[model samples]
Target: MRLGTRGPHNPSYVWRSLQSTKELIKKGARKRIGSGCQTKIWGDPWLPDQVNPCIESVCSQGLESSTVSSLRSAVDGSWDIDIIQDLFSERDQRLILSIPLSRQECDDNWMWANERFGVYSVKSGYNLQTNVSDTSPNSPSINWKFVWRLGIPAKVRNFIWRVLSSCLPTMQAFLTLRVEVNNCCPICHNLPEDDFHALVSCPWARSVWNISSIGSYFNSSCTFADWWINITHRRNQNDVELATAILWCLWQNRNDVVWNGKCKSATAIFDSAQTLYSQWKMTRKLHSPQINTEQQTMQERWIKPPE
Candidate 1:
């Protein structure tokens, strides 16, 4: 007999209805060529009779179905209801318990549940749950030297790098040690130290950095030494100006905030630094005759942008 054929005694109503559905969905022509007309034909196991875009609803329902299938596959008598109840939270277990069961179906359901949702199973060597002790073999390990390569000042960089990478628990460890309470920065009163208050959290410093286009280039791991070294080594004139403006603005802003209680905007800082650096350069050129060639050369070498 041909597959899916109806006996002469029975009506072919089911096949006719399937064909109508295929035609209604424009798949009749495709079906005539032997193409399967099911959502699962495209390898999507999760596509329901209707598609739902509400993520939470899909996740909760999908998880329950998968959990049932998992438990049905673990056929050993060693499956423990008591352990499962304890492993999953009350809410999770409640959802699992709600799935219907019969005497014959219980073993299959239990195996599937454990395989799909089981937190622990020794017989199948599949443990679905884990704590910190059992880590994935592919988990990333930290490289201390690669982190150190940023060339931040040793004392400041050590804590800054750790903070940036989430290795340190809190910034207070660095802040409290450095800042003075009486002289605390007006904006961020948490700490009042040169490094902590000046670079990281001060309202004035934050504003200044925010306005400088180069401010976005900064990372907590970057330090004054790192700033100096990279700027000195940079070959491009535009990049050198950008780096110079950032450093100059930061230092000038720090001094202004500390001395005059003035918080210059980032644009103001950038403009002032560029103007000052230009004037300083012009003055040095005019004064070259007053100084020895070696001293003049040293001064020029230190300030000139690296080629």
Candidate 2:
């Protein structure tokens, strides 16, 4: 289908929607042609629908003079092999030769190749998007690489992501869900047990940060996510890693207080984070693929997004 250009007033919205529609059509549409007049033998997707973009062959330098109409005789929809052999590779020629011509005498039309009976529906469109996001083999977010590839255990990485994303079941989150729970910080009882209160602003959490080297970074102009973004953007891998470990340790100690009312002191929290970081370093040294362990330590580890 022909798509309209962007509107003058909301050009970005129009352009982005138009571009995404083009991508969907490129992924989902295929031709059903009565005659070969409208399809290109080279650039267009007139081939069979097994491939996503039904064009099966690439001619990087460009194809020799060819068109789908050039593959058939005018009087009858029969293959004319001479031109096909001259322009296409043997495999492409065979692939083209395999396609049966339409007998219904209909005009060329496009249909969704991914849907049953070649029909499109809003449900089908939604399902196509759902597949792209969750079920497709290649759909994992590149952002996840920063979380999953950390040198900590898988559970720890997941917990770190929850805290960063504010997905943790902090007391404030429970209240937002309308679940019956106390709002005050269970450890300090000074504020709502929101992510910031539980992780950074509570008296207990503040003491943990104060004892840590990152205490200098704990300032007034910071939200939990602002601090997290700042930590992730720093050029030093050591700082990123240390921040991760410290946050993880802080959250763990907070849980200890909330669940058991017995948690580590600020000094003990810092010491635990240091111990975790050191063990990770020593373990990497033990399993080093390089001949020099020091070289691996010098190598950058964090795969942060460009600022």
RMSD of each: 25.6, 16.2
In model 1, the clashing pairs are 70-112, 70-116, 71-111, 71-112, 71-113, 71-114, 72-108, 72-111, 72-112, 73-112
TM-score of 2: 0.48
Taken over the whole model, the C-alpha lDDT of each candidate is 0.41, 0.69
Model 1: CA > 4 A from native: 1-185, 188-216, 235-249, 289-307
Model 2: residues with Cα > 4 Å off, grouped in runs? 1-149, 216-221, 291-307
The TM-scores, one per candidate, come to 0.29, 0.48
Give the CA lDDT, 0 to 100, for residue 284 in model 1.
Answer: 52
- The top-ranked prediction according to TM-score is 2
